[model samples]
Target: MTRDFDDDAPRRLQDAGGLINARRRDEAERIRARQRDDDERIYVVTTNLVIDAQEQLARRRRLDRIWRAGAALSWLSLLAAVIGTGIAWGTTGDLARFVVGYLICGGLFLMSLLTLVGVYFAGRNVSSLQRLEAHLASQQKALWQLKVKSNPDVDERGKLYREEVTTAIEYYQADSRKYRTIHNRHRRPRRLCGRCGQLKRIARNARDGQPDLCDGCYQGPDAICSICSRIRSCASRDEQGQPVCVTCYQRHRTGEPCARCGRTKAVNTRWPIGPVCVTCYTAVLRSPAECPRCGMVQPLIARDDDGAEVCGPCVGFAADYTCKQCGRAGNPHSRGRCAHCVLAERVNALLAGPDGTITPQLEPLAAALADAPSPFPAIQWLKESPNTKLLARLASEGHELSHELLDELPPNRNQRYIRRLLVHTGVLEERNEDLDRIPSWLEHELADKPTAHASLARPFLHWFLLRRARQRAAMRRHPACADRDLRRRVSVALDFLAWTDQRGLALADLAQEHIDDWIAGATSQRRYMIRYFLKWTTSRRLTRELTVPSIPSQEPQDLLDDDDRWRLLQRCLTDDALPPDVRAGGAITLLFGTSTERLCHLTPEHLKFDDEHAHLVLGRHPVLLPPRLAELLRQLAEQPQLRPQLSRAHPGPQWLFPGMVPGKPISTHGMTQKINRTASRSAPRATGRCPPSLLISPARSSPT
Candidate 1:
């Protein structure tokens, strides 16, 4: 029989057994010879090697098609369900025809619902396959190399290795209680990374049956850390034990108690005498002192045998302590320049104009920052503070360093900070921050408001509210409350105008009935605010005389009884365990009914110390304090440690109640909170009057 040969005859003959195909198959098998892994591609490609890469590519394309098909099936099912429901409900015909339509609809709906459920599973499969492909791509090349190079492989070494890799990938992808034990067991054989002291995995060596270094740490060699004098990776242990570069090591290290300063903090280095924290180390290194033992002007780092101070050189320490620029005996920070010089350089660089020189306007600020008591903080602030960028841009652009220019920028916290810094440094003249910020805040608040509302609000904010605020500010009083009230009034005014606009009414046409309606619907505080706006508008003759009923002030219903009041006063006098500020502040609140606002603003000047008695000058008259309360106030006033370090550095009236912010008294709200926590029940509950029991003497009023 003569067999007719077609075009596919040669390919079929080759498929049976061809030399070229056999050669390719041998190479592929050789590549995977040691790879005893139950890998799908390896299992499927026993005879056909030419199809491996092509098949892998085709699998990815096929997944894409499968995903698209699933999505199309989902849409088709949705369309069928919608059309079937519409046909079933909307069809109008004979009863038999309606029944037939309903049956067809039910069948279509059932089939579509089944199709949708299958599509949902198909979608999930596609998503899982895509995730597997991503994991395979990230690791396949390296894993193949590792598996091929694996020497004297075990019977199922490739299988175990592949399973572990897959588990690791899946474990990282999502944590599961099922995989947790396996994951932890795989991670149990951990060793300190040779590069960093951080713990890492130790893979098993197939030949030696011993642990080997993980792939990551094995790629790098350890180097000497110049600062710590340790053989470590170029990365040093930073804050929270995170690895950071060597240059930032000192700044980022987790701190310990320094032997010299006796403070728990980040130490710069281990000196001859003891561990020294960064601040103390920098202070000693920068400030040269005459060594009592060596009689040489150098940084006094250690005490001698006789307990006399000595320099690094006197103690035979090898580190260089000479500033190359000034020839001063100090540990230089960068480029052999002392910290002071480096700070000055950085400031000059930050404030330099196009001509590479500090402008006269910014000279004072530059001088102040450079001449800071501690240069390290100044350097750090310049390096990391966001405010530095604002200052740099202003300086580089040669903009005049004035209050108006700062006010022109957005009224953000950073802008306010820069303005305060400039004023503190005498680069800009001082102004009332609270009073000055209102107009800027108003500008931002009104930027998006309707023109009609803006017209009504601008004058109310500027002429009436700001004028009264300025008068208060002029009297050397803080206008924090006034500023808050002004902003509230303006916000309410705009809301009222918007309300009127929504109802197609104008402010000029706003009647007493409308004002009454507005007041009735508003909150108590808001009612008062709207009344304030109405009062302002009436005074300006912008609107007709409108009667906004005043919110009646409710009298106190929770005043302390006579016995309780006396007991609280006695506690204030005798309770030494109570915080001094709280005791003093609570006593004043109980006796004279002084508000928290008045208490926070009380300066040392407000206390009149006479021969026999002390008087707190609360208002126009000075109220005499009892002997014990007088003593408490005296102790608070005279103690230097009571004031913040920053407050002491500046020239200002010392607050009786000092706050954390320099040159500012404790905020009224803060004072109120503190008093409420400890002695709120002691407070006089009446609005304007003190308790009537104050007229009686403490000895006579004592409870029998």
Candidate 2:
């Protein structure tokens, strides 16, 4: 029984040990469950905190985007408003439209400016929110760290938790400080105006103190001048003991009595000796001087040949001799004969007998001179004049005198004067041709055709002639070239009309086929000349719709090669004997490739000179003139006699190459002829090679 008891005790002890171990395990399990609950609670809290922080950050980012969008929209609106303003300014023509456009644009611009200010403040707010979000994120991180800490001691755990809380609080405080900084950065101070009671930005005056009123409501001090009663900062006391502005002060100072006249009028005229009134100054200029010849005092004076001052009447008496016949003061002449007497003597010699009696051959001229008011010009034409002899000879032959017959005579100034005299004396009648009187060639050509044909073509013929007459009248100064062109155009029209009339085709029924047929029959060189007539007929609606074939462009056959150009340039540069007009014209053509027509029209006005260089307005831009060409043009400008005679109807300055008539440029044909003569003389000499085509071609056909 004792041995069984010992073994059972050991077993019971082992069982007791096992039971203690199980109890300890059960306690540990309960503690672990509690710890897990705490951990889960901390994790849930941390997660919630993180989610809230993320949401706030997301909200801040959205706010930031909104601010950025607002800023972009404000800038875009500003740009659009600016563009609209520019468009309005440029396109609006009337005052009302301009005002409306400007108002609209201004309103848009102001709104955009206000929107931009709002966007800036919104952006600052977003930054503050972002900082707050950062603070929240920092708190979340600290909470997470606290949750993961494994400290067993309560004090240590509490210390860790307190440190995290303190850190979060510090972060929160820092974020708040940052937010305040951002807010303050954008904030502006405002104050209420004392006078207007309106909130406005503070504006301090350094001269005085800050104004209690806004700029709109402020009315400070009055600086009214006592003399002018005008508000001016420049007001001060004048010497007259009155408050005055600078303008009034100056007027008062100048209003003092003049030293010479003692008048209160403002002294305008000042002399080196003293101030003089305008009236006194004028009196000084008009002071009387004693005449040396007549011993008379006169206001106006003149210098005599001996350098003696003389009165106006005395000077005129001394300078001019009295004509015994007309009792007029005239220039001195030979044998005590005045200008009129000398001219009259020459006229009497031409038209009178040896006994000084008027001859029958010149009775009409003598009668006209007797009837004239002033016969000096008529008498002047008889002195050593060829037109006088021609007229005498015509009168001696008993020829029927008319303007047409006189026009057949050679053109001369004296001849024109004699014709005017004859017309005035009724010896010659002016010729006025009837409109039906066509050219002899056309008249004879139409006589052979049917009367109906002539009648049908008469209107067209009249039209052509009338058009030519109009052109001639417009360009009568350029008669030679104008007549030549008119002849060519009229001849073409006549021939075309004759051809169509012979074919029995009415002008209104005319077609392109008839025109093409005429063109085919015409000379190949002149086939295109009919295009002008066709255009005229079409414009007059005398024919049906017609499309004249275009004249084919011909390749230039006279382009100057390099060697030819060099030789031509050398001729222009080295040849001193060449006429200046030719040399200048050739240089201009070779350098600028200008046509003769354009060159003829060039005036001194087109040549511009500065301190540095000379320029020629050739085309759209000015061409810098070469030194040689500039010197030649200067010489040309100095020679006024080189200009052609201008008509009495249209008198102007002479051209570089004046035409036969006054006030007209040189004829293109005449220039071409002159250039041809020059080119012929200056043809290049070669060494065993053919002359260049450029040198061989006539100047009229040569390329510029």
Candidate 3:
């Protein structure tokens, strides 16, 4: 007991000093904490309650303000008007009381009008503001509730906080019900940086419409490949010309051996699905190296029209059905037979049938198609008339009928007779004695519209032209042309002038500088050509003041002395090739010839032989043919390749040098462009020596 006591006493003494010091320090900390809490007394619940009251009061006040504006303005205006009218009436010597009474009534009426206007505008504003406030208050309810719960306060804070907290919870719970909706409308979630909250994009997202990063984040390309971890930024592409990205490029540098070839060359990763690199993605899509059907490079696609890998005989073999009569299966879409068989069967069955063959079900269609060259003309006839008139009209229009036409004919029961007439007339026209091939009279009519239709359209066209020019200018100047703004403007102006000329507007009114300015601003070769044609061909006479410099002369020998004469020669002989028809020829001859106006169309037959030489018959009389010019004509007629048979399939049908398109001949202006295009001059394959020779208008005109 004595020994134990002695040991405990020393230990107690040592602990007593440390324990007392710790106790004092802990007690002091407690006091300091309490004081700090008392000093910064936070009343969050009270704050939220006060804010709620303030927002409600402010909204009510705004509503009251709006409502008062109309009432206040009406009352004030009435008072002012009544006073002024009364004074004015009294000045005119009216009884003052009566005048005051009458003015009061008039003022009241005026007040009513003013009141309504103010109320309309103010009421609308109040309604809009109320809706916005309601939305904002709902959205902010959660924040307010959170603020209150975080800090307790006084003065009805508990009730306000409790009510708002419930509302906030309800709003969230209501939104929670849309979990399925959110999932259903799932947009891709962006991957953001954990460090700085930056988002990542898909690979190759920057240029080429495929960016891997936003503009600021993109470091042109990876310096080293992601896959191989080799540095190859400066290295050239592989044998296939693919630049590997840095992460993958590191393993492929020249110093490092290629995995494929095992040589010290730039490495490229080959993918089974797509191109070697993202840079070549677009190049492959247009003309992919791999065949879609066979998964091989350049598979043969003789069978499907869309170029399927399988041969023609095998394609649609599964889909094809056996033909009843022929017992052969063909294109399924053609109903188990070839188009030729179908056409022949259609013709034979209807006209003179083998027994029990579907008795010529489409008599009207078959007959109508016999004359029409294409189905469009035959269908158009059916659309216009029922029977006889349609055939007459189709024939008159020079439209032919075909087997395809019969099948394609639009079904409108009203014009059955027209179909019959169309079929018979087309068949007769094909025999060529019907005088139905786009008749000379209709040609006359196309040139000469009825006076009334011409008059009606001309003024409207002029107005339309003015409005369109302004609109075209605006479109050319829009944001889409940030790269080529000036060039687009020039092209638009030149196009407008040419369109105006084609619509029969005289170019004589426009000036040359108008065209020159347009050309000067144009950056492309096509635009330059269009600008040149518009001024020199279409509007040269109208724009006498504007001097377009001659395109540098490609012609080696001849130089006209007068500048204006050269311009006249260019106008007379169009730079572009013209159709060899009356309309086209007349325009060219009118400009080039001294008197081509009186002369009319002279066919090849018109050029007759007299003993040894041929002479062309003009309007009525024979003009002596020039030998050299005659040789040029001979060349045009004899050479199959050089003669330019407008349509190879239907040759020698229309006027000489026909247009490729039907319903329109080559424009005289086009003739001028064809002449100047040093055929092959700028192209690689062009022979350096003299090219094809043809007669052009003499390079001289009347002296200025």
Candidate 4:
């Protein structure tokens, strides 16, 4: 009996331990359940309120329908009165009877007008209900948040919603007072909506003595804006007594030349020097300049006793604009941080991963954007640009950013722009855009083509056109014409294939006569493009050897006379008002007969400086430059950059004429346009022989 008792005691002890753990787990689970209920209470209540509101709206809509039916009955009664009046005047021979009938008809008309007014009020109520329903449905989370923060239990409440919900919450809180005033549940609205005729809270315009308007009716006073020339809610009137929108009013009112930037803009502030625009005012306050008096970096407010620039403190005035974080003398952007600091924080936030650390891949791009000379534009771009959102999404998702990943996204201008920025900042490797875009373009073109046509055209493009293009792209930067040329060749080849297909003729069975017939029907330029496909197919033994006749060079029909040639040359040499690139490029075209395509490749190295003159290496031989032209070339070469901010970190060759894109020279088309703008007339192709007038000039003649 003692042995049995000992074993039972140990088993009972083990069971007791298991029960204690189970009880603890159950208690914890109940606590967690209570927490969950507390957390979800606001959302649950908000949902219930919305559902009740919707039900009440439906009941109100039913009432509006009944009102509409009564309005219809009123219109029918008015029509009956009109007919009765006509009958009384025609059938009633007595004047007294007819007059009485007319008076009764007039009373019916008055009643109908009153009914129409009721119908108008019903329609306005319907519109208001619809707007409120949409707002409630779309802003469910906002409603939940409002309820949480307005809870009476919490002693101190932090904001539970973003800035976007501030207005809505303010309006809701004002309306909430009506419910709180238990004695008067149906408070009268302050003002009626002018447009809708619904009674609601009134908000008055700050300026222009506009009418008092309810929230729904208030859009600002509509008038023809003088600057934009569109009827809109005018912000203010200009000096000419014409209405202007908010944007135009700010930009055009009290316009004056800014002393610092030398741009005519609306004066925001007055300095001793002159009127300053808002941009220049902010820039001057924020950017520290070297004070000549003390040789210290500070804002220049006043001149010293010696007539040299000095800091505000040097002149016994304390500085007002200074950053709190960095302690730099500059205008604060937000939270007492300067624009530069704000830009850095915003860039870091935009490029940070889900872990709140920037990826190694995106660090360079973030650095470039943060380190921009002007922070205002960068800040504006962050707020408005869709590209920033795309970058944010990519960073948050931790996606491996590459050219291939970017290509997978739908091809758009934004995608292309982002890719260019990434490539410029060394985040992505540089590749020829013209070459890379061809494959996608070809795929889109072939998507609707027949299988036979695609199969035939695919090999020709891959082996012949694309292969040659790849080789060209590898050698040098792709010319602007390369994309158009490749596309033209591909399109013509496809057309040739399609034409052959239509006639039920195979390439293997094709003859020279078929090629001739096809070329005969094509345009003049397409005739030359078809030769590429013929040569490739012949070499591949896909078709018989075909002879595509070469297009003979046509003589110039509009050659410039000697007077015109000299006049353009003189303008190129003497016109200081013309752009440096135009003057230099136009002069070279006239002298050496150099094509604009060749001029695009010319760099600073092409110009040789000597003791007396400058020589340009247009071809293998260098040509002498006139004194004025040489000075222009020297100035063009010495200038730092065409676009300093954009091309600051470009690693490409320094061309005589740089384009907007980093790491690229000016395109042939861009240079030609510049020349055309200056010359005022397009110069025809010159005859091979040099003009006698050019031959006499030492600058025009090529050196031995």
Q: Any runs in candidate 1 off by more than 4 Å, and if so which?
A: 1-291, 294-300, 305-338, 471-481, 552-598, 602-704
Models 1 onward score TM values of 0.52, 0.35, 0.21, 0.58
Instruction: Please report the TM-score between candidate 2 and the true structure.
Output: 0.35
Over 4 Å off, model 4: 1-266, 272-287, 317-319, 325-337, 349-357, 374-397, 407-420, 430-437, 469-481, 595-597, 619-622, 640-650, 677-679, 682-704
Q: After superposition, how far is residue 500 of candidate 3 from its true place, in Å?
A: 20
List where candidate 3 sits over 4 angstroms from the true fold: 1-602, 618-620, 626-653, 663-665, 678-704
Compared with the true structure, model 3 gives a TM-score of 0.21
Return the clash pairs for model 2, or none: 646-662
* lDDT for residue 517 in candidate 1, whole number 0-100: 82
Q: Distance (Å) between predicted and true CA of 207, model 3?
A: 32
Clashes of each: 0, 1, 52, 0
In order, what lDDT does every prediction score?
0.70, 0.60, 0.41, 0.71
- In the range 1-704, model 3's lDDT, one tens digit per residue, is 34655768888898999999999999999998886565435344444545765566476566567557757766776677667766867787565645655666667657766766765665563435555557456546644555555455665577676776676566456677564444333333344533334674322233575434533344345455444556545233556665566444454444434332345543243323211332232223222234355444321223344534442224433222335556533322253453334545433333333343322333443443433333233344333434534433333333344433432444333232233233333331222211111122222322444454344233323333323444554654211111122323333444555455565654566565555665566454334444433443333243354554555444433423344334433433343443223223332332224122122222346556667786655445666654544443454344343221112222333333433222122323233233334321111111111111322333332111
Q: Give a tens-digit lDDT track for model 4, residues 1-704.
A: 34655768878999999999999999999998887687578667777777766765676677567666767766766777667767766897545665665567567657766766866775564545677567556656556565565563543233444433564555466667643452232232466656566656665532466555776666567888889998888857777787789887766566889877799888887655567788987767767787776676777766666766567777666655677787776656875688888988999999999899999998888888888776777788887789889888888988879988787666665776677778888888888786686667677688889887777677887888888888876776425447767788888888888888789999899988887788678656465678898888888998888888876555444456678778878887887787777787767777777656667877889999999878998777998988988998899889877353443345666788887555567766566556655555433222133443442222222211
Give, for candidate 2, the lowest lDDT window spanning 10 residues: 683-692
